[model samples]
Target: MAHGDITHIDIPVGDTQAARTFYSGLFGWDIAEVPGFEGYPMWRAPNQISGGGLAPRDASFTTPRSYVEVDSIDDTLAQVSSLGGKVLMGKSQISPTSWWAIFEDLDGNQLGLYEGVTSAE
Candidate 1:
């Protein structure tokens, strides 16, 4: 992932299993339920390229969202606020070296920010 690059995407789905089957069967993607994620499934494209996840949609999250990689989640979020975007979700640690956050643009489109892996345990 590079700074300001679309690193991942999330597709909202009503049914995780159905989505998993449809995507995996249709595109030969490797979709599987990840533990500790409440059955949410992540997918890898057949060519082993782009990857994303299928998250159960709710009132707050009802559409597909693309995550843009950033060098610093905190700094990027500050910039987002300064630019008139609202932070829907604060920075959350996805792993020891990675973090993510969600925000809504001026037009109310949801987008995500991802801090790429770092040298951390």
Candidate 2:
């Protein structure tokens, strides 16, 4: 809330290989899949992660969304409706301490939310 630091960006494309090639050839950056994370490949930028990724249309994922990291996703979601935004997907756990959710603003701008920790009840 005090400072805005963009951790990374995620771009959605139909084909990962083609997208990777296009970006690599154009920007001279290496976008490769990390050995362990087979499917996920982070955009390798000179300074910060620029953005890259293929849409997992056929997978358990829905339409691609861009995630924004926040201190607490619950508070953000709470302010959604008041700010004329609607939650497309409720808070869900991605990992032991990571949470994500999809939402739509009044202008219909789709956004993804990410919280650092997933509280255990």
Candidate 3:
């Protein structure tokens, strides 16, 4: 995906199994737990292109968070700070090739940023 495109979303749920069943039954999404990600079950929509994880709900993660694809998390976080936004989380690794971060906008809406390198590269 290109920069600024929404690549992933995280839905906070109290019950992973219930949420998986509800989403899969309601939207025909394929929800499953991938290896190495035991508690976090990922769900892929019928379209197959759109997918995200169902994270355990917490005080800090009470709502859905959409992750925007970015070229660089460092640069984007800098821009966000310059624009009066606050970085809630610093860049964290998902894998060797990917990283994610979270920031709160001026309006206090939290959003996530994703930076990944595809194997094709």
Q: Best lDDT goes to which candidate?
A: 3
For 12-82, candidate 1 gives per-residue lDDT tens digits of: 99988889889999989998766656677789897676888998899878888999999898999999999
Better of 2 and 3 by TM-score: 3
Model 1 spans with C-alpha error above 4 angstroms: 118-121
lDDT tens digits, residue span 1-121, model 2: 1213444456666677887888888887768775544676656676544554444445535455667778778888998878889998999986677887878988877888877743323
> How many residue pairs clash in model 2?
0
Using TM-score as the measure, what is the rank order of every candidate, best first?
3, 1, 2
How accurate locally is residue 27 in candidate 2, as Cα lDDT from 0 to 100? 83
Worst 10 residues of 1 by lDDT: 112-121
TM-score between candidate 1 and the true structure: 0.89
C-alpha lDDT of all candidate models, in order: 0.86, 0.68, 0.92
TM-score of each: 0.89, 0.74, 0.95
Predicted model with the maximum TM-score: 3
| lDDT tens per residue, model 3, 12-106 | 99999999889999999999888767899888888988989999999999999999999999999999999999999999998789899999999
The lDDT, on a scale of 0 to 1, for candidate 1 is 0.86
Q: Candidate 2: which stretches are off by over 4 Å?
A: 1-4, 49-52, 57-64, 117-121
